[model samples]
Target: MSKTTITANGQTKNLSLEPRRLLADVLREDFRLSGVHIGCAHGACGACTVHVDGVPRLSCLTFAVQCDGAEINTVESLGGDDAHHLLQRAFREEHGLQCGYCTPGFLMTMAPYVEEMAAQDRMPEDAEIRHAMSGNICRCTGYQSIVAAVRLAITQRRNGESTQ
Candidate 1:
């Protein structure tokens, strides 16, 4: 067993795990982050996306040993203990999720994009949103609602409004 240290969602833990274990397994099974869904398990589905060192990456494709000292942010870090984040609220308002299997990936992948746009106070076109979200595949509905959610979140953030 390899002794690895991973800081997840603001909590740091030292673990002794197999060298070949996937980061998704460590996050879900060890960290108890159930939101890290395993869809496709080949990194194509994007259902296991999470932020490692402030960048979105496919957890399923990453080995836990590779992230020995990395800071990982899962979906749990988005909202407060009792409140939803702006993107999450926008998603719910716009009905961006149906089956919800792919929501976590989409959230992790798009959070930075939306935050960047909001920081610039820029409204993104659907094409730009589509381009940013191209890496994530949502098999449930068309991309319209997801795009709408991104737009809504951008707007809400730019205006400094909280959905709570």
Candidate 2:
């Protein structure tokens, strides 16, 4: 077993886990962060996407030990039940999700892109949005709603609305 410290969803956690354990397993099984889903287990599907040190990464392809001292952000960090983040609200307003199995990963993957665009005070074009989100595979919603949701969030952000 290896001892590691990870800042997850704004909470610092000390963990003792097997070195070979997948980060997805550690997040879900050990920490009970069920939002990190394991799909394909191979990193091809971005269902297990999470932010490691503010960059999106496939948890399935990463080991628990590899994330030691990393700041991890899962879907849980996005918001809470009382108030949803702008991206989450946009997703719902735009019907960006269907079965919802892929929503968490999509949200994790899109958060940075949206934030970057917001920081630049610009909304991404449809093609740019598609390119940025190409890594994540969502069988449901056909990605149209997802793209629209992102666009909406960007618009909201530029209109002086708080996204966080």
Candidate 3:
């Protein structure tokens, strides 16, 4: 087993894992962070999405050993007493989730895109937003509400709110 240290949700954690162990397995089994679901064990589905060094990646396709020294964040870390991220609040207010299975991945992926949109002072054009979110698929909500929620969060962000 290889030893790996990762900062998850702002907390440092250490674990022993096989070099070939999938990140999804290590996260759910060793860390007991069941919120990181494994959907398509292949990389096709975004269900196992997580942020590694602030970039979204498919956890199922990533090796635990490869995550050594990485900073990871999951949807579990997306909210706080300081405030709910604008995306989280928008999702709730806009009813962005149906069964909610894909919500976490959507949030993880969109967070960065939203920041880019604000930084560029360009409202994410529909094509850009769609392309950015194409990797994640939602079976239950038909994607309408999800897109709406993202748009709502963008508006809130443009109005001077920090969603991250």
TM-score of 2: 0.95
* TM-score on alpha carbons, each prediction: 0.94, 0.95, 0.92
Q: Which regions in candidate 2 have their CA more than 4 angstroms from the true location?
A: none
Error of 3 at 52 (Å): 0.6
Which lDDT tens digits does candidate 2 get at residues 1-164?
89999878878889998898999998897778898988799978799999999999999999989988999888988876533989999999999999888888999999889889989998778999999989888898999999999999989988889877
Q: What is the C-alpha lDDT of each candidate?
A: 0.91, 0.89, 0.83
Q: Give the Å shift of residue 50 in candidate 2.
A: 0.7
Indicate which candidate wins on lDDT.
1
In model 3, pairs of residues that clash are none
Assess candidate 2 and give its lDDT: 0.89
- On residues 32-58, what C-alpha lDDT tens digit does candidate 3 reach at each position? 777788888998879889999989999
Better of 2 and 3 by lDDT: 2
RMSD of each predicted structure: 1.5, 1.3, 1.9
Candidate 2, 48: how far from true, in Å? 0.8
Better of 1 and 3 by TM-score: 1
Report the lDDT tens digits of candidate 1 across residue range 87-132.
Answer: 9988888999999999999999999998899889999889999999
Task: Give residue 164's error in model 1 in angstroms.
Answer: 7.0
